[model samples]
Target: MAERRHTDIAVIGAGPAGMAAALTLSEAGLRPVVFDMNATPGGQIYRQLAAPQVDATLMGQEYIAGRSLVDAFVTADIDYRPLSRVWWLDRDGEGYVLGVLQQGHSQQWHADRLILASGAMERGWPFPGWQLPGVMYAGAAQILLKQAALLPSAAPILAGSGPLLYLLAWQYLQAGRPPALVLDMAPASRYRTLMRHPVRAWHGRSYLLKGMRLIADLRRAGVAIRQGVSGLRASGSDALERIHYRHAGTWRSLPGTLLLTHFGVVPEPQLMRSLQLRQHWQHEQQCFVPDRDATLSAGTNLWIAGDGGGIGGARNAEREGHLAGFAAIASLGRQPTKRRSATTRRLLAARRRDLAARPLLDALFRVPEGWLAEQPPETLVCRCEAVTRGELDEAIAQGGSGPNQLKAFTRCGMGPCQGRQCGESVTRLLASRTRRSPDDIGYYHIRPPVHSITLGELAADDFDNTNN
Candidate 1:
């Protein structure tokens, strides 16, 4: 039997958003339980910040700034559960029940009011030879660098469109290891979008300055950067040996042992989707975002914050967390103090300022079109089930209307990953083939057991359980 417990307020994820929410609630005299899948606090953006294995000087200021957040979180009175993965969330009467797996045991947690701050994940854009051993995501590479001071050998090639791709290249340069080449895949359409929003460029000048400085740094470090790149392909007999991409109407080949690719990031939507919450397709960002109100309230007993709600980065996430915490406090029948109200207003203003640069960044880093058209039929779309593009096309030709029908026909999403890696690609492909909006095509109908667990773990009863 699963263990059960209850809390007045609970916050999912221990990233910047969740930590901020919990801290705010704790300061307001409510102890919120925070569940984090990682072994430590500080989600991906601040990973290993508390006990960094790598050098702080090389990681830069943004990373070092997380120390204060993690330090406050550690010293707080909040209940922090590290290495605990919430696999299921269900509405139980007026409350919510979360099924969490930790240390090979299943436990259930109940919360009167919940705040979800689940962070984002790197978007997977598949191509030929992407399944090779030496192919990896730039985000994954950054994680390795942060957690283990690991760097790719043999001068890897970085290919993708996004600030993250360039950020990773800059980090490598800081570590005295530079990439062989950086292929910028941002299409020409990005300029038109930018031109249409000149005001956004002015509002987000700081962001633009930072991006320019990063590019200049890479150039000073002698890193080869190419723009308008497309048709990225990894080729080798076994591991990655060569990267092929098109630039300026010419196909160029670069021999490299590792190929790090990153298109962008999207909200991790499994838990929110499983709860049957409202979602809207964000065309500018090219992903689905959880629908919420001004206070980030999704329902009577739930609030969403951070990248899980939308990709507004760390500062935005922190302010949203404070707002959500205040909202949850108000929902509990407590009137906000005048000071708290003032703080809330300040947080709202700061959040808006933090997000001022978002429109410009979104337009500049938009995912390029023709992804499916550029992909060969043999390319693996769903790496979990080894589903190829041709197989999905055949299933679509056989009257498969949506992701669910295609899953039934081709087993495209029924795997260990459960559609995390391929869901966006699948949705985009269906929308392209059907000439419909992604909103019409919809996302996968996520069910319970968002993360896989063993039967033995589910049945274990000797482990320490909680009921409060």
Candidate 2:
């Protein structure tokens, strides 16, 4: 049997949100345990900053700033667990139980109150030949660069829309490896729509200025950028050799060694779904986000912070973390001091500023209408099970009500990824075909064991597990 341990409070994920939350709680004289899958404290945004894989100067100032947060977290009196995965979460009476695997052994952690800081994942962007080798997400490439100092041997063709695409391109440019071409899927009309929000412009002036600078730098360095792009696909026998896209009402093909694509990101929802919290479709973000109150409370004895609550960036996530920490402290009957109350107000204001330009950003990078439905029949939707768009359509035609039924009709989400790779595509495809909103169509019915694990591992006792 797994060794069962108990804590007064627990924080999941060691990202910006998690670190801030733990720091706040620790300062209040509470010892909240933190669990992170990464070997280090900094999440993806500040990844590898604690132990630099590349020169710190190459990562830019935004990354360099996170070192302070990681340093503070490392020194804080907290039970920090690295290289740990919480695969299953269960409600146990008044508290909760987390099935965690660490260092090849399983242990159970019981907590009275929990703060879920699980971050976001890149949106699923499926296209013809996307499964080929050398075709990967732009975020994955950035991770490799941060973790291993790896870069494409050849100039890559970066496609799709969102801040990450340009951010990665600029990072590569800074690293002395600019992409061969950039195919921006967002058209001119999106920019025109973005102009409707001038108030947002003032609030998000810093981000806008930074983005403009990145674009200007890339162009000055002679990197090619084309907007109004669509109909992207990759082609090669065994690896990605060429990319095909449409622009200026004409189709063009280009040879490339690497193809990196991004379509923005959505909250990582596997754990939230297991909890069965109320969720609503955010039409702007184009993802179903869990419903939370002003204090970030999702339900009783629980709070959600960071991108997992929605797609707010790191700053917003950090603010939410502090708010959740305060709320959790209040729930534990700790009356807020005047300083804490003032800090809460400041955090709320900062969070509003952090999210002020979100609507404009969302409008500019929104997924195109009928985008999912426009995929060719042969295009794969579920890479895990080799399911195709044609198959999803066939399932819809067969009278399935939603994704759960479609999963039974075809094992699209039953693979090791557990629908993380294809859940959004399936929901959007269903809505597009049936003329229903995604909320009406609903998402897959997620269960426990959110992450894949071996039977032997699950059965092993925590007796010999030093992590316990």
Candidate 3:
């Protein structure tokens, strides 16, 4: 049998939510084990300092906040395991059986309760020549900037939708090399649609102000900020050289070494889904959300927090984490003080209100129609499988009604990444072609070993089916 460890609470993901939950749980007299795939505590939002001896400024305030939380956790009797990727989780009686791969070895951790705060990923929309070299996701560009302090290119074109585009553009301008051009997909009229909700409008004022500042900076920097880029293509034999875009009903091509595109973010629920946690199709958010109660509990002992629940940004994620921590404490038969319960209730209410804006935002900025229309036959849809959009279309046309059939035929979702990138897109395309809702089509079925593992690692593990 594999060696086993136990803890009062197990928090997966060392991002803001997981770190916050661990700190709070420790304060409440519980020893928590926190696992993260990265080498440090900060999640993607607050990525860890690149090197151990690197100065803290390299990571910025996001990571600094996580570091402070980690410091507090250290004093609270929490066991922090970095660079540990959890691949499999099974419910063991009242707790969970967590399979983690660390240092080329397999291990297990049993916990009285498990909190998932895995966070979100940048949603990718397929476009013409998007697979070309130097064409990267906007979030990837931000990661390069945040972790390496390196600009993607000397003259990059920023194109796509969502708040991250402006934020990244502002960062580039602050770094002295503003992007060559800014092509926004969301028309100005979208804001008028978003204005229907006064609360959302109020909550979004800061973003509007930031966008104004970014526009002003771009103007001063002599960078062109165009309203729309309907199409994006990179034409070059070897490296990226020129970008073709459709702006204001006119097609224009510009010379650029790199192109960064984003269509906002989507909940990363692969781990959660693999655990068989009930998920609801969030039509408003255009993503799948884990089914959770008011207290952030997904079921009996499984809890979730942050953008993994939905895309409400960092502040809302922190509030949800605090609620999950209190709830986990309560689940352990500990009675929280009246004051603490009251505070948690208030914060939960605030989070609910904040998330209410997601519907309008999702509807307004939903992936543009015909976004994938120009996808060439050879354009790779599933990077892991190297399956193209045309291949998927042909598979479906040949009576591949669901993801399973499509996978069997084209191997679209059968790769190392295991459909994280292409599953949703395939589901959407399949549903559209068959005249069915995405929910009816359902998400791809997940099996054991959600993440890829080496053969040696699997062979070494003692599979005790009786224990499970």
Candidate 4:
């Protein structure tokens, strides 16, 4: 039989938001259980290094700040279960039933409240040969460098929009191997264009400073930094050998062993979607965000924080998480101290101001038009089912092949990756061919056992395992 556990609150994900929420809840006299897929509590923003003795030197001061927050949570005496993947969430009476797989065993937990802080995922823009062996998301390369101190390759091309591309490029240069080129999709002039909103520009000063630092370093290193590269493609048969792009009314090809591309970040809402929560289009960020109240409560005893709500980065995520914790405690008929409430209100206001600038930033750094169209017909669209663009197009032409029907017909979304890499592309293609809105196309049907589990594990279950 699967083991059963109970807690006052169950926090999904161990990133900054989850850790902050768990710590606040624990301090308020509630025992919260924190579940993380990784073996550590830092999440992606505070990703720890493989070597135990390497202090904050490798990750820089900003990342070390995140480490300090993790340390505080560690001292708060909360139940943290690392390496636990939560695949299902069901309404149980007035609370929630969380289905988790830990160390190859299935388990369940009942919590009076649940906080989702699953964080964000890198948004990808498809192009010719994007599925090449050495072509990867910029965030993926950063993970490798953070956890293993390994660069993507000696001569890599960083191409994309947003601040992360420059940050990763700087990291690669600092690690003794400067990237071959920095092909920025969003031109530098866009920043000046956004300056029309003084409040927004002022709020984003820190990000601007970081970008300036990267540009200065690139100039000093004599690394080529192109500000307007579009129509990117990778070339070579087995592995990535070269990257081609167009810039400033000219086509340029750079020889490199690896290509790192990123458009921006999107909320990692797989668990939230699994729960059938209402989601709405966030036009500012070009992504879907869970419908929630000002206090960050999704509904009932369920709360969502951090990038799972929307991409607000670390500072905004922490503020939102603390508010969710206080709101959860207040729901139990316990009012926090007046001073604490006032402080939280102030922080929340600042977060609002910061998040208000997201629309301008998103507009300046949005994904290019016709990005997915750049893909060849043979390019792999669905990595899970090995479905090519040709296959998806054919399925759409057959009629009645919406995103869900296409999944049923081709098993396009029925993979371990859970459609993270291909869902957006598939939805766009379906909408274009069906002449329907992307929202009308809808998402795939998600069921229990969201991730693959061993057949023996499923057979050993004793309780009723039904999908909602």
Instruction: Using TM-score, give the best candidate's number.
Output: 2
Error of model 3, residue 406, in angstroms = 0.7
Off by over 4 Å in 3: 49-75, 459-468
Ranking by TM-score: 2, 1, 4, 3
lDDT of all predictions, in order shown? Answer: 0.88, 0.89, 0.77, 0.79
Q: Looking at candidate 3, what is the lDDT of residue 337?
A: 95
Worst 10 residues of 2 by lDDT: 459-468
**Model 4, position 180: C-alpha lDDT score:** 83
**lDDT ranking, high to low:** 2, 1, 4, 3
In model 2, which residue pairs have backbone atoms overlapping below 3 Å?
none
- Please give, for residues 194-284, the per-residue lDDT of candidate 3 as tens digits: 6676777666666556567767867888888887556666777787788888877788897887999988888887888888888877777
1-468: candidate 4 lDDT, tens digit per residue: 556778878998888899888888888888788989998777888877223223454445677677667888877888888888887788898899988877666778898888999999987456778878989988898888777678654788888898888888877777777888888898556867666777777777777777788789878999888887766778888998888888877877867788889889988868888889888767667677889988898989989999999888887788777888888888888977987689788988898788877766776787753555556788777877788777778777776457788887777877788787777777777766767666677666567766677876655553334221
Better of 1 and 3 by TM-score: 1
Indicate whether candidate 3 or candidate 4 has the larger lDDT: 4
User: Model 2 compared with the native: what TM-score?
Assistant: 0.98
TM for every model, in the order presented, reads 0.97, 0.98, 0.91, 0.92
Instruction: Output the lDDT of residue 1, model 4.
Output: 51
